[model samples]
Target: MQAVDHVTLATNNGAIGGGEVMLLRIAEALRELSVEVTVVAPATPGGVAEAAKKAGFETVQLHVKNRLSWMWQLRRWDAKHRKGVLWCNGLVPATATWGHRDRIVHLHQHPDGLHRVLSALSRVGAVATLVPSAHMLRSVPGARVMPNWTALMPRSERSPGPDAPFTVGFLGRLGPDKGVHVLAQAMRLLDEQDPGRYRLALAGEPVFVAKSKVEQVEQALAEVDALVDRVGWVRPSEFFDTIDLLVVPSVWEEPFGLVAAEAMSAQVPVVVSDAGALPEIVGSETGMVTPKGDAPALAEKIARIASGNEGVDVAVQHARWAENYSPTAGVVRVRELLDTLGA
Candidate 1:
């Protein structure tokens, strides 16, 4: 490892996504500990570099035609000019800068097939190979867990009425992989059991989802159209205020259930599926869980919870636990990681 004068954070995307969001948060964390940071991203989409500058860091935009071009350009730039430890925010940057020493390879998602091989190659001579959750260790066994954290809401704005229909909320992409279809199916079953007893408030859209996938999910949700309130993209606080509880029914394995954690922070009860790190985030006592893609089981569970107002009794208590993912705790964790890395 070289001297710890500063850290240069390389983003995985030209535009901002979940990994890019964490890159900014990590920069903030490092700056809090008195480490200088310079953010690097592609010039085409040009989001991450611009955002880093706004966050009070130096920024570098690699001129490129596309994502693949930006990657190799980043490698050349780092190899020729950059100093200090390189922090790769995802597999792209990590693989690009693998030959360099004193670098941290952070995997935001568990890769499979060809990507799995790339992940292995990205680990050579790294300070650490990091993943966002313990569940990821099942696939990336050699990586260390670097749990993602979130910004806490000031106070819970939840005020759903007791007499009103039990409102279930979801706050991610409205695609099948997120189990939007499964949720719709469950809501339909609940309606059959007790008509007008339950409803859904969806706070997201199919931004990155393919057109065909979106059509399938929409078709499945058509049966429950009247019961569904599509609220598009919204702030977590605003979304939490309009519902009695939040549901994160991801069908694919989740690297981290950040939305579930955000719901907990806002004093909203959560119903998560047993998919990847979701259960790890909500835990057994703080929230309820059902089998992934099982509409009947999910409907039965939601029915019991909606039948009474007792489901949210642990809301406040869960909010207390959610503080573990707060910025202050994130700073502490970052400090510990850096110290262990001898930075």
Candidate 2:
């Protein structure tokens, strides 16, 4: 097969989030392999275009008024620029690039209702359809599983021992679906059992959410205000440094848990709710798993880790991350796929 000369990564979201983050990382990885890469996004404020530019990538911004407008603009762009492979990063981009022969439709979330048909339509005429987890593959039949990876952090010698108060941390969007409310409830339960034994540290603010949902999250946090440390937006390294245990209590099925992988990459112990691919990402030995949306179960698992009952080996966790969720591992898989597709 002939080599693909360049790759154009098209993102659906205007804002930078997990999917967009993956797009940036994949672009950097492909560039390192000597392939030319360009990012195509909406010409709007708080979109991927500025973020891609800030990261020193070549980018193209389309004058997209909304989703429908973006789809038309993307299709026109793909029609004009057909020499290289077009990688559609989400549903909108996938739909935009529909019927393009040298295109890859990558879906980061499971489709439901009308989205199911939209996802199917997006895959038409594409070379491949990819998802981040095996769990997600169940939703999109014949889609290849491509697990996500995080940029590795420097190994830190931080662990909660018997003497210190066990710091329980929650990082990610402060929204209802993320289960921040459940984490708050779990913290309250733990505090009732033994006051001051556990402290809750929260990072991230609500984004792309309804005002009602934001208010609901705020109200939930208010109930546990005494034990909550609202450390607004902080770097993952800094957040990991302050907490001993990381909790990813998502109610929605997270296609892939990037934060959990980052924690495991740093060799920090984690407790993840059994939602989507979280259990698969964290594994059995490296972290604890609780039932989804169950605060008492989450609290119990947190307490077990705090009391040193759970056997979590940092070395093992690091090894798992190195083997599966490392940047090198993810890059290798992507490069192989691109090579197969001649891209």
Which candidate comes out best when scored by lDDT? 2
Q: What does candidate 1's lDDT look like per residue over 1-343, in tens digits?
A: 4446699999999898888989999999999999999898898798888889888899988899977798889989999878688999999999988878889999999899999999998988798989988999998997888888888754455566666898999999889999999999999998998888888999888988999999999999898999999989888878888888789999999999888878777767788999999888888565488999999989887877776633656555455445567778788888888888874
Highest TM-score, which number?
A: 1
Candidate 2 ranges with C-alpha deviation above 4 Å: 159-163, 285-287
Cα RMSD of all models vs. native, in order, equals 1.8, 2.0
TM-scores, one per candidate: 0.95, 0.94
lDDT of 2 by residue, 1-343 (tens): 3677688999978788889989988888888788888999888745689988888878998887888998898899889964488889999999877888788899999999999999999999988899999999889999999888898877567766767788999998889999998998988899999988988889998877789999988898898899988888999987898898889999998899999899988888888989999989988444478889999999988888877787778778788889888989988988888788874
The positional error of residue 255 in candidate 1, measured at the CA in angstroms, is: 0.7
Estimate the lDDT of model 2: 0.87
> What 10-residue stretch in candidate 1 is worst by lDDT?
309-318
Badly placed stretches (over 4 Å) of model 1 are 285-287, 313-323
Query: How high a TM-score does candidate 1 get?
Result: 0.95
